[model samples]
Target: MASRLTQARNRVVDRMVNAPRDTDERALRRAVAGKTVLVTGASFGLGEATARTLARHGAIVLAVARTAERLDELVAAIEAEGGKAYAYPADLSDFDSIGPLADKMIAEHGGIDIVINNAGKSMRRSLDLQYDRFHDFTRMVNVNYLGPVRLLLAVLPHMRERGSGQIVNVSTIGVRIPPGPRWGVYQSTKGAFDIWLRSIAPEIKVDGIDVSTIYMTLIYTRMSAPTPSMRKLPGMSAKEASGLVTRAIIGREREITPWWVTPAQATDAVARGAVTWGMGILHRNSSDTASARGEAVR
Candidate 1:
């Protein structure tokens, strides 16, 4: 009985968070056919999966990442499969280079029809451990927030001129859920971009430019590899997560979230104090355990 109840609960949760597993392949192909799509962090993980998926759907995928070799390989694989893709290697954290990159993309492809802001850095160290590492926070902010902002600013004029564009922000559930310990750097930076995107979404829609933010749950990706505990946790695969991006592209929805997310957000709002208290206890316990093992509490 207990096992059956657990199975049922999992099913409900899955339905709430997952994109419909059965996607209309032909429809998705038609939606992006001939469209020029830009995907950042395309060398690996979710970005890579999304890039390949978009390319397969007949989009002229512009794959961006820091690693030229990986990007080249990805583009080659896509082309071998009869899909259109181009490798553009650029360090997203380098704010000064974003404008030039945007220009090159526009000059080369006419303009990007969809921009997937999927590149970001994640940090999991506690604030106590970060006293000597201020760079952690700055790096997160630069990659997660400023990098996308600069790129978007550089490309907005072209999008506005065309009066049609879509910006899909790959966000995190941390932005909506109750905050967790040791995730201050990651969550704060992600939240900053989340709020900024939401603020500008209204203004852009008037010009026929759509902006969608996907508040994603944990995914099995290199980005989450640093936390060993996460490996054992139930998480989405990169391909599955990419499907949500494709769905956003097809549906042009304002926001995409796991079905249970709204209820979770409401609970977070109503039980803020309790949530904080519980997290505080968990943090304290974790610190104590580390101390007991004579290990640094990071």
Candidate 2:
């Protein structure tokens, strides 16, 4: 009954906050008409879903990813649906590769009104594995942290010059709710970027750029496939997450979605070691059930 009331209240709040008539997806999309957007990791998962959705909403979309093949498929999919999309293949980790990609987009479209930093990696190897396989941590940091920061640097100048832009970092809730033991490296790097963005928000806000850090929870995507427990829990779908992200970009909202994550973050912060210890127990228990054989902590 308590959960039911929470849902009812959440629905009412959603309607009030989003403006009931605009809560109709199409009307919400119309808010972004003629806007230009660039999404990283657009080859798959939430990134691809966001690109297609934004394109369908009359926003010009430039999709960037490392896999040329997957990106081509995304472009074709959006075009087939009568939406505008362009795919640019570039290894985001390679700083040299970003320039040309950004150049091409600016050349064709002038300047981007929104940028979604959605590229990331998830790792869950046993803590014992780090003794020799340190590359797992290094590679994850390079791909997930530095790569997005570099992309932001590349496009920021244009945004400053234009005096209007929105940047959304599709970060993970693990940074705050880190289950510990295995999440050190992944969350450490993710947390760094999350803080980095916050540090710059005040200065950038004056330049007409809205920077939002999104701490998302478990989602139904390829990234979540290895951790089998997500299937049983209430998880956000790629399309659903994408829709929330899109609304954030369009509405110029700060810290979008997983609205519940804020209280969870405060709990973790106030409890400190106690929170980590509790989460560690939750991790072990969730990973133990037979049904979660592959879904739990690996």
Candidate 3:
């Protein structure tokens, strides 16, 4: 009875937070057929699902991530399904490697038609716990902000020369709404990339390159599994989240956010002080996780 109630409540929350999307599989297949689509963080979760779906629709999938074994497994699974895929293992946080990875992909694949910036790091440590752990800020910035930017710089020229392509940023809804406590590092880094991409969209659009940003809500994945609160909250499945990515690919829209974001943003704009104060109270009342305190998870 308790489990059923939880699921029923979650369904209600999911509907409220996740806007419905219509995706015609035929249209998605037609859009990506014979194109080279590169998906970062492709070894797991949303990235893995997106890469596999794109491949199924006839896209040549370039799956990128830090774990070589996982990437290999993902590629194998895709190919087993009779879809084309290749694995490229490299850490996004290692900024120096991004250029070479992009260059190799261009050389081997002959220029990618689509780029999905889905790789990211999520952190939720309080300011008190973060004071001594400055590397948290740097790691998040490197993975969430600078890494994607460097890869885009490397690939943008080829995209421009071709005069057609699409770039999708799988961003978080936290950037679109009022940021709560314990999400400073993650939200700020994501917001930085979000702003940067939007700022450059107009200039890039002149070259016929479409840039779409998906301000995605939470999804149940290994990345979110560690958070106790997240496990209790309603979220999309990996497959559902990947549908949004394919929607962006097919639609090429400027942004895909929840139905409630506009009003939430307005509320934040008007009552920022109150929001901040409330967040502060929440912070004061809550304690950091064991992992945030440099302790191992059992």
Note the clash tally of each candidate: 2, 3, 0
**Residues 51-123, candidate 2, lDDT per residue (tens digit)?**
8888888887888888899999988988888878888888877888887778778889988888888888777
lDDT scores in order: 0.86, 0.75, 0.90
TM-score against truth, every candidate:
0.90, 0.84, 0.94
**What pairs collide in candidate 3?**
none
Best of the candidates, TM-score: 3
Which segments of candidate 1 are over 4 A away from where they belong? 1-13, 16-22, 287-298
Ranking by TM-score: 3, 1, 2
Q: Which tens-of-lDDT digit does each residue in 164-282 have in candidate 3? A: 99999999999988998899999999999999999999999999999999999989998787677787777899998998999898899888999999998998899999888988898
lDDT tens per residue, model 1, 1-298: 5698897986776666664543578988888999999999999999999999889889999999899999999999999999999999998889899999999999999999999999887767777677777777778898899999999999989998999999999999888888899888899999999999999998989999999888888788977876677776667889978988888888888888777777777887899888899899988876422322233322
Model 2 lDDT at residue 137: 72
> Looking at candidate 3, what is the lDDT of residue 284?
85
Top-lDDT candidate index: 3
Winner on lDDT between 1 and 3 is 3
